[model samples]
Target: MNKKIEKCAILMVSTDLTQKQIAEELNVSVQTIINWKKKDEFIEFKDDYQRKYLNNLAAKAIRTMDKLLTSDSDQVRYNAAKDILDRTGYKPTEKQNINMSGSLANPYEALTTEQLLKLAGDDDG
Candidate 1:
């Protein structure tokens, strides 16, 4: 609760160091780090695994967007949607259920998150 403790907690989160790493550096137990999180005062940093996953999702989204911009094919459209889903870490939200009579290449139509996820080569199973 001291200013020094608060500063340390902020520094730990900003540096991408996990709770264990910060604890080791500060000569404290991991439980202390967890306690900070539970109290909503601060939390652990982004571990390598989380960073890698975010990077992968960003790359996938970029590639898919490029494909959509270059090609007007139905497949390309599907790919764009898929990329968005992959980057977002959630299913796409559809506002309507009716299918319109436009080329599937169009991105402004209604498509299920499942369709986009499939196109992006992601596995939900």
Candidate 2:
């Protein structure tokens, strides 16, 4: 196609601009920009590929953290991770789950919060 359009694709992938933003700047319709994206042509830039990969990894790490964060016990953590992986298409490496659980000093922190508060009693006296 046009060299201008090829350059536009590279620019769109390299920047954080939305389709509307790029379209407005390039004086093209948003639909045209979106069509470019759907063909994966716009995402061919090195920065764009890296950004997408990093975002995916961050998302998966966050999901694993979320699964590990809410547990009150080892069994609970195991169950939660299993459920989360099942729902999110995360593959559970045996070591990955075990490592996640190992990172917690106390998974029962939530249960202790109220007990600590009760021990402190009311300071509003």
User: TM-scores across all candidates?
Assistant: 0.31, 0.31
Task: Give candidates' CA RMSD values in order.
Answer: 15.2, 15.1
lDDT of 1 at 74: 82
User: Candidate 1, which ten residues in sequence have the lowest lDDT sum?
Assistant: 40-49
CA lDDT of 55 in candidate 2?
82
Worst 10 residues of 2 by lDDT: 92-101
> CA lDDT, every prediction?
0.63, 0.67
Candidate 2 runs further than 4 Å off: 40-125
Stretches > 4 Å off in candidate 1: 41-125
lDDT of 2 by residue, 1-125 (tens): 45546656656656788768878888889888767666644456535656776787888877766867586788878877777667788876544223355673543465666666666785443
